[model samples]
Target chain A: MTDKPATPRRRGAARTEELLQVTLDLAVEVGYAGLSIEAVARRAGVGKHTIYRRWSSMAELLLDALSRAWTSDLDYRDTGDVRADLREQFLRSAPALSSPPIGPVYRAVIAEAQSDAALRATLHERFLVTVEQRTLERITLAQSTGELVDGVDLEFAAEVLCGTLYYRALLTDRPIDEAAVDGLLEMFMAAYGAAG
Target chain B: MTDKPATPRRRGAARTEELLQVTLDLAVEVGYAGLSIEAVARRAGVGKHTIYRRWSSMAELLLDALSRAWTSDLDYRDTGDVRADLREQFLRSAPALSSPPIGPVYRAVIAEAQSDAALRATLHERFLVTVEQRTLERITLAQSTGELVDGVDLEFAAEVLCGTLYYRALLTDRPIDEAAVDGLLEMFMAAYGAAG
Candidate 1:
């Protein structure tokens, strides 16, 4: 490990990852309300001035940290069947949402979004738009392949599936197990019908 | 209007309604964070003892007041068609939810529920259970009557539809208008299909 010296670019990326990890850890322990620039700096063992230089405010820092944490790419594999692709996505992602760190962070962000207009706006622009747009695009692929009907509303279907998942996670505090993934997919297929 | 004397039961109910109305108005004016039992009593022109007698705490008072404002009960009219019936129910409730007063109150309650176990328990018992059960029952009726498939997941579908409308109302501050209701229903019908 001591054989080679690291480049500045590699060092910068490493430092960024460290800051994000600290942010996530602190967010879990004390929640969004307890989060602040000073605390994040102290937690990361970095100066408050450095944190401010990287991000304008705590909200900005937290948003960046969260956006980076999410596996930023959608896995819209054309399983040759549209419904099957959606089922795969849900199965993969639902568990992450149900897990400890992600679940708590998601809930805290949602609670904060209720009252924080600026945070809500950033949430819509960064997190929500990507999910909604990607889901629609995947649904559109199904429609073009004649897997779905000509006039089906993809946005509405996407929202029903994704929005329902978020609602259940926040509202019920129940774990989204394999059974729920199966049931949700089945219901979606039942409503949308199977691809030929 | 002043010609007839009010009956005892009618008079009691009227006074209760007046108290709830005043509470709602104060909530709108001050907000959840600023609301106080004394303020509510003063605004309602009722004794503080009377307010405390009716509700054990501020959370209970808020719940009762908001409950009075909700008109979520469905008519369950046999339209002889499940799709039409579902669409009508979804559309009929959308505008009221999209209204400024109702939407904010919903957000306030949900935010309060996160930290207050008492509020959480009451919300689940009073609101969530009723929503889930009634929607499931309605969908079950459709399934039995051959309007939907027997394998359709009633619980998931009910949650999906309600959750979608609710997420839109609470998060976006956008109107869940007739168009959105139509979009949601179209997707639901497409997924459920015409078979029983």
Candidate 2:
């Protein structure tokens, strides 16, 4: 059989995936502060222009790497019990955030965002907002079904629920384990649970 | 009047104060990522050895600067009400965190800490631990007084209380405003408030 030549589109897609994987590996090894286009290019054996052509800045490139490597489902499962669903989701995704390529890289990005306004907005728009919105959707649905108390500000509740996890994960040495998750959900349910 | 010659102790103390002030100013201007002993020396017109003499590393120097500039009272006032005290404290100290100098510098250090184990430990030991402890003390007292619900984990409570503010401050663009504080306290009270 004759070998078929790869089309330009296929080649471009393959190259993009390779570059993203390289970016993730470098991020895990050296962190975001140590990462630069030159370092990635050297590691990938590609010209600096090859990276710049694909990404306008290091933040963009790193974010793409994060997006590609993020295998956890951001959407919450509708398990009928809102608290159980949130607990399941938190437990499922906590490892990705607490360890490895994702945890360290995410921390670097958040840290960088402290100094970079443009990056902060992008992170908010892309990642945090999605999580917050999903939490809100789940909680709002529960409220509508009379599973939660009416007249309470569900938005604030959503922020606290999501905010507490990020707080434990990023700010302190405290583990976001079952105990922590239960403590949060207990407070949440107490505050928002329907009057029985 | 003839000028008195300064004692070496006084001179040394004054020089230390000046260096700290310079460090704070530069931290506000360039942030933690841009800060270095060399840069501080250049800005203050002192040799690098001067900074090295006082602080072993940039993290040490920055932490000292933070300690010096941290004028906000970390201790909660025993105003006979746990919720009110927390609200007052959060409101009183929110500006120091959300505004320049302390806010920006602290965020930079936190970002740096993600990859730096030593800095993270120092931060947790020197700053976060103190805040969490004080919070625990106040809440524990409230529980004893029957102001808060008994049997709840106050340590976890303390973490969430402090963590949520930091989450809004560092991780998201959400304003740590009166509304945010009130909402947090509301959930806290609902969950932990003594039942009538």
All candidates: TM-score of chain A: 0.75, 0.77
Clashing pairs in 2: none
As a whole number from 0 to 100, the lDDT of residue A60 in candidate 2 is: 79
Model 1: residues with Cα > 4 Å off, grouped in runs? A1-5, A45-57, A67-99, A129-155, A173-180, B1-11, B45-57, B72-98, B128-155, B172-179, B193-196
**Candidate 2, overall lDDT?**
0.84
* Candidate 1 chain B lowest-lDDT run of ten: B69-78
Q: Write the per-residue lDDT of candidate 1 for residues A74-181, one digit (tens) a residue.
A: 567888787778877876776665466765676667677777767766666666666777788988887887777677677877777777766665665555667766
**CA deviation > 4 Å runs, candidate 2:** A1-65, B1-61
* DockQ, every prediction: 0.45, 0.53
Clash count per candidate: 6, 0
**Top-lDDT structure, candidate number:** 2
